[model samples]
Target: MAWWMSSSRSEKGRFLFFVLPSLICWHIWKARNKAYYEGVQMRLGRICHDILIDMKGVVEVQFNQRLGVQTFLQLYEGTAHPPPCYSVQLVGWRVTEEGTLTLNTDGCSKGNPGVSGGGGILRDSLGLPLFVFSTYFGETSSLRAEVLALATRLRLCM
Candidate 1:
């Protein structure tokens, strides 16, 4: 079985293992095309740096996740192990000023085009919850769930 198919792989690792290569390759391909078609040239090191930065953005937007034990970034940085995990203190949502409401929403899926759900909380100025909801969409992508969650909240608020 492929490493990605193994049951032993952490979800974060599996995700990155599959996605990072594809994304990096795609980025390289696009850059190659840009160089050939548009007469743009970037140093090899610069191209690598851009691919790495883009990879970080891809990981960040996915729930701010990180690989548990190992990561490509470790190899890129020439480190055998990633830095130790740090304790974080999370604070609840707050409105910038009084009389305002904040909507915090997120969506996730077991797999792309697999079981998905959207969730959110409506909070008052002081972070008091006014309403909260989460609903599963039988078979869908996380992106669809994100849009659905915002749509649902819009209808509910009006």
Candidate 2:
């Protein structure tokens, strides 16, 4: 019935501009109600879910083009547009000789908080593999593996 709603529904771009503000407002209102009535704070996960639900129709209409444009604009505004540049740089220069110390470590987890393994490879400066070691842990977190990797690397360095 309203003029904005009528134009919004008829024009694709207009519809997105009109609905976006309302969707944002609705999410805020719902979050307030959830906090006040249920005494539960909204988490990032829930907020993200609600935003996805609210934007579903608009996203379907625009097919991600407008969304991508919006993201690009945000980034552009946040940073001055810099000219694209490329450069070649050397890495791993220290690993040039056989006696040079080189360590590479990685961690793998079956699930986020499930079985985990941390492994590392030690090589001399010449890139010759000196040792490969792995450790398995039960009911561990990825963060734990990361910490263990750091600790193990330190021990090897010493």
Off-target runs (Cα >4 Å) in candidate 1 are 1-92
Q: Supply the global lDDT for candidate 1.
A: 0.70
C-alpha lDDT of residue 132 in model 1: 97
Model number with the top lDDT = 1
Please provide, for model 2 over 1-158, each residue's C-alpha lDDT reduced to its tens digit, 9 standing for 90 to 100: 23333432324435455566787778888888999999989776676567655565466566553333334233223223233468998865354654557788887678888888788988877777889888876677898887887787778778
Question: How far is 145's C-alpha from truth in model 1 (Å)?
Answer: 1.1
Off by over 4 Å in 2: 1-99
| CA-lDDT, candidates in order | 0.70, 0.65
Error of 2 at 126 (Å): 1.6
Window of ten residues with lowest summed lDDT in model 2:
72-81
